[model samples]
Target: MTDKSIYRIVFHNQGNIYELYAREISQSAMYAFVEVSDIIFGERSKVVVDPSDEKLKAEFSGVKRTYVPLHAVVRIDEVEKEGRAKILPGGEQKGNVAAFPMPLKPPID
Candidate 1:
């Protein structure tokens, strides 16, 4: 918690797992906004997660936020402390869970 560090992890809420390795690679901190199918309630919610303990707890309370190894993630993002944006990578588009990528500039671009 001294200098800003880069951390990547897969957020686990119940059985559903949203892959987030690729999105947290280069950034000092990452925010993963995922649409999870709530097994407990049978509903979907937009869960925002991050690498920092403070930021994660502040933003996500009811939702479970677990830190995961960056190597474990497929998609990563070098985002600010705000952990801006959310992506729902599966489920019906009409439903709360939708397949979407993090809004970031391509490396080649």
Candidate 2:
């Protein structure tokens, strides 16, 4: 594969589904998080405006790398080209979509 190959990462975050394109996806050193870097987004063109994509761009604007929880990841695919990054609302209306629950901390004696 060429160095420019893009990867599409689909993951769940705070009851939302995030679709992102990046050049790198790997197991993070930070334990159970997946490391994603070199995120790719469609160029700003006057002809088209995607609110979902715009929201994602602003959310990840200053981030160089992101570590996503492994359990939240739904799928990952290597693609020939990058696509618009977007965030989709996910919940009961989306059918069977739910965020993983975190374990409760033990009570201090």
How many clashes show up per model?
10, 0
Q: For residues 1-109, could you state the per-residue lDDT of candidate 1 as single tens digits?
A: 2234333334432223443322223322445433222111111244643344333334455753334433334444333442322333332237476333322333664
In candidate 1, where is summed lDDT lowest over 10 consecutive residues? 35-44
Residue pairs with clashing backbones, model 1: 9-68, 21-73, 22-74, 22-75, 22-76, 23-75, 23-76, 23-77, 24-76, 24-77
Tens digits of per-residue lDDT for model 2 on 12-46? Answer: 88767899999998899899999999999898875
Give each model a TM-score: 0.24, 0.81
RMSD of 1: 14.4
At residue 78, candidate 2 shows an lDDT of 98
Model 1, C-alpha of 88: deviation from truth (Å): 0.8
**How many clashes show up in model 1?**
10
Give the Cα lDDT of each candidate: 0.34, 0.84
TM-score of model 1 relative to the true fold? 0.24
> What TM-score does model 2 achieve against the real structure?
0.81
